[model samples]
Target: MLKKYILFFALIYILTGCGTDYMLSSFYLRKDFTWPTSPSEQKSLNYYKHVDGDLTKFNGYTSPSILATPANYLLVIYEIRDIPIYTKVYGVDGSSDMGVYVAISKNAETFSATPIRVGGIADDYGSPVSFVKGNRVVVLATGGIGFGNGKADEITKISVSISTNNGYNWTAWTNVIDTNIFKPLLAKANRFYTNPGNGTVLVNGTLVCMIDYKANGADTTPAGAAIIYSTDNGITWQLGSTLTYSGHRWARVIAERTDGKLLIAAVPNTTRNVDNIYNSNGALAWYMADSLNGNISSFQPSGLPNNSGGSIAGDRIQYSENGRSKSGILLLHSTPNRDYKNPGAGGATGKVKNAMSMSISSDEGQTWTLITNAIGQQEPYDKTSFRQSMKVLKDGSIVTCIEEGDKNVINDTSNQPFFIVYKRMGLSALSDGKYSYEGL
Candidate 1:
């Protein structure tokens, strides 16, 4: 039995070497490597004040627009205070409610104190953002059940709230896109993509909203996740085609490049149970997809990089499945360690470390090359994880935020709910290397 088991393992390794390793090496290779300097040497800014409620916690803080401008500024929005966990069982009776608050930061680090409240909305969860375009500042939020009932079907709605006086005062909330319109046929069996998360961007003077929607049948199956665009500045929207893949996927961020192409990154939460048991034995993977002129190409290198040559551009173009001549889709996502059997468990047991992994595509979305895994230690829980928010600074330095400290649970007299127990991180120390920011 022992010999047979060894033989089986050897056979598996051989197959993986010929399959996974070959494909990965063809696309992904470590670039000029660097590491974060000492913690003290790292530059970062954190904003947290003890509000009236000891349970006041913020999650999903995002910028309204990826391309930052002085006149447009940056708008950060989040939910303040806590909700009862029991509300998940008893339903939203209005006894417990979460409020939405907004803060403007000119320098991305220092923020204004006066947080304006946007009324008529309930449970503004996930990454809610506000951006300025011409005369209007558009605020988009992910809608959750007003009460914490877990069963409530939350609709991903786009709310248009305009602010003329630099976000000082805002108009009433108006629903732009309803999730019901994009609901999949298998609604009950697959409901994860029911709500939207993260930030929104205005690409080429058109409003583009990216969201994660559920695909019915299996948990490991890929759902209907896509980017919806509105040419008339959020007045009307047209949904693009859904992505083609099988896994637990959610759209997180969108950015427009200098050449007027669209770049989108998504976090695919694939677990062992979902992968081995449900997803036909496929490993969990995070993906980045791109689209040129509303048509998605292959994945390419995201953000800026050193020595970005014709290879990066050409490979992404070649692998693009959408029949477009765009570059590759750059993928930056967190993956679990090998020792762990599942994603969530690995994350809990320090077996799932948050890593900043990258891939470059020259031919478009069809093929890709893996770049270096830059951030975090190899061991889980040993290195810090980059929060979903990432921005390219003026100095050409890549800036990403990490949640600092341990996880904590907040408790009221009657209920206890899990709240993110950490502070926001600013800039981190860059590893020793020659850095440049010519275009930025």
Candidate 2:
């Protein structure tokens, strides 16, 4: 009888070792698991990080957008449920799968309960953004295919929802533009394959957005980026003049420059290695575009080596405080760099060299200067931070939103899992990478 029992145990071990990752993950799910009582239980730091959009034992979150309004700061996130794929195999949420969500914060530190969630809309895959148009705020979000976040049929569309009360509440997502409207213009890439979304904004008060559509399901065979712009408060959108650059990733709307110049920053897809890390030649391009007219100029490099080139661009969010006087663009961006082993202890995940670095551009998208290299970088494999949103306070402090993880890989015991992390960087001591709200 003891021999029989031993034989059964051995069989179980062999099956677990040889079985598919999904099967193994399913087995583990059958075990007892507990969701964290809360994830924002961090010690006080001047710089802000996660605002309740974090990972729990059961649910995970991703894609953070930070918008500063007169009353309070609004942090919007796309919630992923059913915790699929990488999160499933080990374990996470689909920012793209769930429609839309928002969490409000008065000072970018403490957050209210998940205040707003809009559903039934497709293409929740892209980053959702908020902006003050007139008295109300508008949220622009996208959903796409190939995210593996469980959108049944290659969902591709950009949607708009409005909040009259500064993110305390929100309206349902209304599909602004779908793949069918833009597919005709993107025949160049054959189709927008694996066209995962990036960002949206009110460029120079004109709405500009990006949408990717694929021929088949997550085929990503020839990924494409379809660009669009609107002048009439997103009532209508214009298609790109040419569909050649469908391969641009992290395509985003930079603010309307004081000089009346509209810009778009993006990186070409071919600049990276098979591992999805940028090779030596990868470049992040900023294009001078029109908010009303699309693709006013070709995308060009910012004359800077955006190290590893995962930098995403956003509008020149204004902040006026303190006695210091400077006349230039205050461009806030989210950046990422290569991961590395610890120089001393050399842990498996290694010290995140600079996964979630922050850069500021006083030169109107021409160049970027690193402000903090230590805030959001976490774990090893460090591919977690990308295409996030940022907002600056009146006192020169900043709040940025991003998803943290090790790599975009899947493993049960893997160190990385997708969760939204909001970091605060102080204006006074950027060198130390501390969050000091002294001036504000």
C-alpha TM-scores of all predictions: 0.53, 0.65
Question: Over the full model, what C-alpha lDDT does candidate 1 score relative to the true structure?
Answer: 0.38
Per-residue C-alpha lDDT of model 2 across residues 105-163, encoded as one tens digit per residue = 65455666654674344345334555565556666665443333354443444566776
Worst 10 residues of 1 by lDDT: 308-317
TM-score computed on alpha carbons, candidate 1: 0.53
Residue-wise lDDT of candidate 1 within 1-440, one digit each (tens)?
99999999998787687898664553433211122123343343323321112223322221222223345344444444444332121111224454456566554434566667754554443334444457666566544432222444443344556566666676666665545544443253223231232334544677665544542222324354666666666555565645544443444434454355555544434343312211121233223434523556445433332210000011011122233333333333333331333244554543323333344444333344454444322223233222333344333334333222122211133232222221222222232221111222
- Give the top-scoring candidate (lDDT): 2
Error of 1 at 250 (Å): 1.1
Top model number, TM-score: 2
